[model samples]
Target: MLISMTSEPELQNGVGVQDSFQRLWTPHRMAYIKGENKPSGPEPTDGCPFCAIPAMTDEDGLILRRAEHAYAVLNLYPYNGGHLMAVPYRHVADYTELTAAETLDVAALTKQAMVALRTASGAHGFNIGLNQGSVAGAGIAAHLHQHVVPRWGGDTNFMPVIGHTRVLPQLLADTRKMLADAWPVD
Candidate 1:
């Protein structure tokens, strides 16, 4: 396995890391964050989907990898179409709350997820990140996990600049199949 390295500095203490994450991601959300607590996205209601994925044997919005401690699902509101998130089963809020084993397991699952996404989506590269704290842009700032998003050379362009719309080329289900076929054992 290859180790991931980030030259990005340790998140600055009071810099609204969440906003930075948001801006770096879908620029359309920039308006919502100008003076708001949350951006306009799918709000987790009742039972959080990440927590419920393991028990249910369904795949409506579920994209890929359903397991005991780890799972991958397509972001309903994604930066890119095949954007995937590897979340743990428990309902922990921040990264510091995760045990070393859970942290390691999450990382392993994330790497495999990136490989799976690449095989299925034909992405040239990726932007894998974690929104650690609510202050750090954790939309579900409640649950901690890493997002593995695929990117192509000219994926982001004029619309996001002039129209404020973010476009993705493929259906999430197709992206799911590509991923499932690539990493079915998990």
Candidate 2:
């Protein structure tokens, strides 16, 4: 005789127990956790996503704005909904390697990113900085990029704290379009 597991209920709970929690399935995040698009090494040609982003169209690369020496793009793995990053066109591993012109452009673009994020998302504030190396939490240490993360009051919730997951309401492409359209005209 074969015992059928299909007849069993998924779970059994006490009379007072209730399953009220919901799961937010974000399968796309597996790519990031698995380091799919990450650079192989410090070389620009070694599969560096930042180095390759400029070559693609704005929409395709999720680029919000482009300057002579740098550009602003939506973070693929954003900490918040409207996270952005300012990166130099030339791939460099360290902030100290930036030329004067590159440095200026990156700084200007970072400022513009805050404005665009504010206009597009009504962001209450921002956290802007760089993680220098892999040891310092830089996901792509091969390319220098400054993060411009938007923050709102009470934005942090139980999801990130208890579930170890972030629930971003808008899609990256949509966020990119919003920021690109709201970018300051210079």
Candidate 3:
């Protein structure tokens, strides 16, 4: 939908100078850049999505699987396709605060996520961990969650490094279905 006014050396609308590079428009990322949906406070009632998602339906929440104390859900802003998180239902901010049952459930779900991603997408490796706090890069620091990011050989390319954009081949809905189908049924 972006029409280039490159016929002239410079754009009259103050757009930009004409360049030989092609454009890849990812307007959806603007919401993230603008900090949309970010929680205003540290409480679950303060619009924390991790606390809210468990109450929604699986498809609506992009949830892959649910355990007794935790659940596995797809990341809304994924670092890679099939990127997911295992979150404890309790609104605990720190990992050390997790109950024994919650800890076991979260670990189980994270393992299930890895299995599902590998089965569905043939992921070569994984990046799995928790961002302890906002300072440690937790977007939603009010809740505790463990990330499960699938990785493949040569998945990193110049696009993310130079353009600061990640190219995801499949829609989030499709990925959710695929991983859900591949989830280990207990």
Candidate 4:
């Protein structure tokens, strides 16, 4: 049987299969998929993103706040709308390596991030934790950072499960602006 190019074909079950989905061609995501932004080596000077981000301007790095020994920056690849990470400047791989000062600063920054995210996005809740090593799902295992993921009701949906795509409603820069503006002064 000859099939017409203009119309969708019928399946063996006699149901018409229409080509409905419009492709959201995210070419920029190719770099992430190919691991382009990942660090070249274990050393901080060897292209560690967490280590390098603090050196850049706040807008350039999507940084929300900076403390003495630690800082908070928006996640480049966010699982949710307002995902952020609190990281130490020293580029220590393990949490145990943090000095008392670094530990306190990181914790303070994380609390500040939560308040910023809440004020910026009005998020209902959050997921805060750390993935220690590559085996534990740390994408950048050479640096230690605490993830602060904002959550909303029904944010989990079929798109991620069925299409393997996350539907982010806002741009990263815009999200950064909102969080930055909402960040506490102290």
Q: Which stretches of candidate 3 lie over 4 Å from their true place?
A: 1-14
In candidate 2, what residue range of length 10 has the lowest lDDT sum?
1-10
The best candidate by TM-score is 3
Off by over 4 Å in 2: 1-21
TM-score of each: 0.69, 0.88, 0.92, 0.87
Compute the lDDT of residue 143 as modeled in candidate 3.
93
Tens digits of per-residue lDDT, candidate 3, 20-135, equal 87667677888788888788999889998998898899999999898999999999999999999999999999999999999999999988887888889999999999999999
Regarding lDDT, does 1 or 3 come out ahead? Answer: 3
Candidate 1: Cα lDDT at 154: 88
Model 2 residue 56 CA deviation in Å: 0.3
lDDT of 2 at 162: 94
lDDT (tens digit, per residue) of candidate 4 on 33-101: 898769998998888999889889999999988999999999988899889999999989999999999
Candidate order by lDDT, decreasing, is 3, 2, 4, 1
Model 2 alpha-carbon miss at residue 69, Å: 0.5
lDDT value for candidate 4? 0.86
Model 2: which residue pairs collide? Answer: none
Q: Mind sharing the TM-score for model 4?
A: 0.87
lDDT of 2 by residue, 52-135 (tens): 999999999999999999999999999999889999999897999999999999999989988888888899999999999999
lDDT for 71 in candidate 1 is 69
